[model samples]
Target: MSVTQADIDSAATTLSTVIRRTPMIASRVLSERIGCEVWLKCENLQRTGSFKPRGAYNRISRLSDEERARGVVAASAGNHAQGVAWSASSLGIASRVYMPRGAALPKIAATKAYGAEVILEGSTVDEALVSARAFADETGAVLIHPFDHPHIVAGQATVGLEILEQMPDVDAIVVPLGGGGLLAGIAAAVKARRPDVTVVGVQAAQAAAWPQSLADGHPVAAASMNTMADGIAVARPGDVPFAHISELVDSVVTVSEESLSTALLLMLERAKLIVEPAGAAAVAAVTAGAVDLSGNVCVVVSGGNIDPLLLSHVTTHGLTAAGRFLTVTATVSDRPGGLIALLELLRDLGASVVDVVHSRVADDLYLDEVQVTVSVETRGPEHQRELRRSLSDAGFLRD
Candidate 1:
């Protein structure tokens, strides 16, 4: 079924009472850096920390009495699980969410907190999806797919409606594609409203399904679950979304894990916003030079449900990318005073030592020249060089 603007209109009205009208934020720093008016569509701040709640609520509210009585079921990597769980809970409807065993702990906890029955089924989303479908059939519950179905696609299109309402002249929009619902919905609404506006899709290099799907003229097996953008790590494009992707989406770009980490960190530090790796894929594409934003650009930050531990890693990685964090390994004498001397030099150079390892006997040490390995954290590359100079001048033997 074709997604019409009428469906988008109905979805907007159906979900308006439940989902938030997420903010459209402007960034002068990004504008200056990218040489364009950079606006961030902050869906990360939407209900359930994603835009899925819009379509999920829309789809569930339309269920018949029998379907509602039987309850709802869904399988997700993370964000959509939370969305479905939250939406079902708000309607006083029972929901069983099948999540991959490897789904993020925080997402699992959040889904459970929404009062949905959490089922950890497999290591990958596809495996869990098979089980979810079977469970739905066995229990006679209504299966609410993450990205497929006419109502779901129309519901996702509400995001585009909100964006257009927020910024009528938005020049270009960069969307993150996983199951293709979000991309398809946004593309349908945007191209229908303003066909001249550019719409681009961003994918993680490790799980770039859309590029191949577009090439093969059909949905195909995406990459394995190796990307940090677990939100969009869908192995195949949904049929509903493929329809819009073929016609409306202007381009599909892929970004690396390193790019995602850098984008996540930058959003945290500069934008004061916390976006998950998947949510930050569009920004990653911009930073990685995958998408050209020569004119005005609106980067969709799709979700903010990032794991704290992963956030820490992304932050450190971002600092490294910005030359603000430096890690260096150096050899010092294993002797107590020798290690202390190196530590003092590092302190003098304004460098902090993160870890230290000492070797009492080494393969290439003199009679009294035991070796110690030090992993010091410096403020930046310049501080790292200064620390190296301080150590070399302190009579430390080079290894």
Candidate 2:
């Protein structure tokens, strides 16, 4: 079944009570970088911490009473599970979600908190999908696919409707590509109304499938899939979304893992917004100059449901990439004030030490020699360089 603008509009009205009409904020920082008027569709702040609930609720709401009684099953790495669980709980339907065993602890807990029976299996969403399908078959429960069905596409299209209304002058729409439901829905909805508007999709370079799929004129499996943006790490594109993407999407681009982490950190520091790596893909594309910055562009920040542990690692990587943090191992004398002298030198260089470890037991260090590792916060690349230079000039052997 094909999704149409009318179906998306119906989805909008049906989902009004179940979802939040997330804000579209004008971003001066991103606009300056892209040389265009940029607006961020903050779906990260939506109900259930992502846009998944919109589709989940809309699809489940349309189920027949008897089907609802039979219950629903779904598989997700994270966001979709919470969406289905929350929707099922609200509709008085039994829900069981299958998730990868390595899925984020917070996401798994969140799904159960929303009143679904969480089943952990497999190592990836594709593998977990197998278990979910088996469970659906065994229990005679209706399966809610993450991004393949007509109802899911139509439901996700509501985001396009809201974007159009929120930015009538929008000339380009950038969204993160996963299984393609969100991109296909938005492309179909927006292009149906404004054919001239450019619709772009961004994918993680490590897990991109849409670019090759589009190249071959059919859905194809990715060579490999590894990315911190697990939300968009589908190994293959959905045929349903591929159809809309082929006809409507103007361009698709991929961003590096470094850029993804940088984008996440930029959103957190510059915009004061917490965005997952997947949610920041569109921004990464724009900042990396992958998207054409010719007109008013709105980037969909897909979801904000990131694990805290992952966020911590991403943040550190981002800081290292931006040269805001520096780690240096310096061999010094193991005298009474050896470390203090090193600390005084760092203070003189104006680098704030965030963490330090003093070691004298290393094989390379002599009895009177200590190796000190210092993690320092700097102004940026230049400050880090200056700090390194000062340490080198002070006779500290850096390794």
Candidate 3:
């Protein structure tokens, strides 16, 4: 069934007490960077740390007495699992969540902590769906499709209602596109209310499906999904959400891994927001110039359920991309004071060495020469260039 404004409104009403009204705040930093009056719809702060619970709770709460008794089953990479688990726990329903074997450890633990029977079944969400469907059939439980159900779409649409209520002057809404639930929900709500306002969707370049799906006028399966933004790395878009997207979304754009990392770091450092890679997709699009930010734009930070290890790696990647960190190898004389001289030079250049490695006996090294690799912190790209120039002027052979 087609989701309408009334359905979305009904969802908002149903979810009013079940979900948190996530904040929509102005972001001067993003505004200056994107050349617009940028606002952040911080769904990252929502209950279950995402927008997923809105849909999960809305759909689960509507289950008939018989259906609730039968319980529910679902598959997800991470976010949706937590949502369903939390919703079922709240409603006193037994829930089983089939998650990818490689799903984030924190997510798996969180789902189980929320009282769902967590089963790590496959390597990808699509493969996990096979197990979830089988479980539903075996147990006679209702299967909750993450983004395919009308109730789920209607529920996720509440975010759009909040956005319009929170920022009436908003000229555009940028959302992260995975299976297309969040984008479709927002698009339907915004387009139905104010067709002039643009609705843009962003996806990770490595795992994007909507671009190809849109081209084929159907849900096209991506050949492979690989990216740090694992939350949005769906193999295919949901048919239900795809229909809304096809009718309402203005544009779909893809952002690179580097861009996603950079955006996550930007949110953490500048906006003081701890955003996951998927949650940062909208910001990535704006920073990467993948979308037009000519007017008052609202970028939805969809979730903040990133694993600590992934966040650390993304932080390093972001620093490297920003040119604030550098690794340089230099050939030096194999004397005791040779390393001292090099380090002194680096100190003089105002470079803080974070790590150092020395290799004396190597195929590439001469008998009298040693290879010294140093990782250092710099002010930025210009400071990095200055350090390189200093090293060159000091007669150190850079490798």
Candidate 4:
């Protein structure tokens, strides 16, 4: 069944002292860029570093005495696992979580720290779910579906209620979509309270399933799922969430991987926020102009639990995508002064050299020429173009 305003209200009351009422912070940079007032709902700062706890706790707390005795089993990439583990531990209920083998190390550690018996299963959440379902069947534990239950949807709706309370004049709310629980719940709650407020859902283009699913009038599996936003990389939308989304959500859009990285980088640099790629989906959509948003826009930052190494890689990728980082191979004369001259020219042109690899022998290199691969930092696209032009003019760039 679909979640209602009353259900959302009841969930809010249940979560009144349970979940954090994350702050809604205004973004000057984003507001200026978007030509509208933009506020960021910082659910990234929520307990367990995500909004999953709201749904996980709400769903588990409502279990019967017998169900609680049997405990709970769930499958997730990371955030949801931690949510379930922490929620179960808080209620003094035993929990077992099946996580993908590729799930982040920090997330695995955090889940165990929350007192859940963690089992590293398959390579994806879908595969892990198979094992979790089996465990539930064998052990009589309740299987907590991440985003496909009425109680989970009702619980996530509290975020929408909080948003409305925080920004009564908000014109739109942009949410990250995966299995669609968050988006569907928010849409249902917001539409019931303020029908005029737009509720848009953003998905990673590579892992997006909603566009095709919505078109076909059912939850259809994505052809492929490959994106750094692992948290939202569900192969298909859950039937329960799809039902609510089809009827309630105003729009569904997709943002590119480059946009996700760029948005995360922007949040880190401009807002001093460490948002995971999935959490930055809404911001990515806004920055990429995927949706026509105006008036007061609220972008929900869903989670902040990102691996440090992945963060580094994504930051570099973002810089490269934004034309702030450049890598080029140039032919230089095989002389002692040639490499020095190239470095001097780069310095004079206001480019910061990050790394350089000098090679004297290659399949395409000539006897008198040395191949030098240089990675440089530029101001932006214009600066990158200028650097390339200067290199071409100096006869360093071949064709």
Identify the candidate with maximal TM-score: 4
Best by lDDT: 4
In the range 256-300, model 1's lDDT, one tens digit per residue, is 888898888878878999999999999888877887876778889
- In model 1, the worst 10-residue window by lDDT is 327-336
Report residue 113 deviation for candidate 3 (angstroms): 1.6
lDDT tens digits, residue span 1-399, model 3 = 689888998999999887999998888888888779999999999988999999999999999999999999999988999999999999999999999899999999999999899999989999999999998889889999999999999999999999999999999999998998999999999889899999999999999988999999999999988899988999989989999999899999999998999999999999999999999999999988998768889999999999999999999999988888999888888987999999999998899999999888668777899989899999899999999988888767655
lDDT (Cα) of model 3:
0.92
Which segments of model 2 are wrong by more than 4 Å? 361-368, 397-399
TM-score of decoy 2: 0.94
In model 4, the clashing pairs are: none
* lDDT (Cα, 0-100) at 308 in candidate 3: 95
How high is the lDDT of residue 47 in model 1?
Answer: 84
Clashing pairs in 3: none
Question: Can you tell me which runs of candidate 1 are displaced by over 4 Å?
Answer: 360-373, 379-399
Candidate 3 least-lDDT 10 residues: 390-399
Q: Which stretches of candidate 3 lie over 4 Å from their true place?
A: none
Model 4, 23-134: lDDT tens per residue? 9999998999989999999999999999999999999999999999999999999999999999999999999999999999999999999999999999999999999999
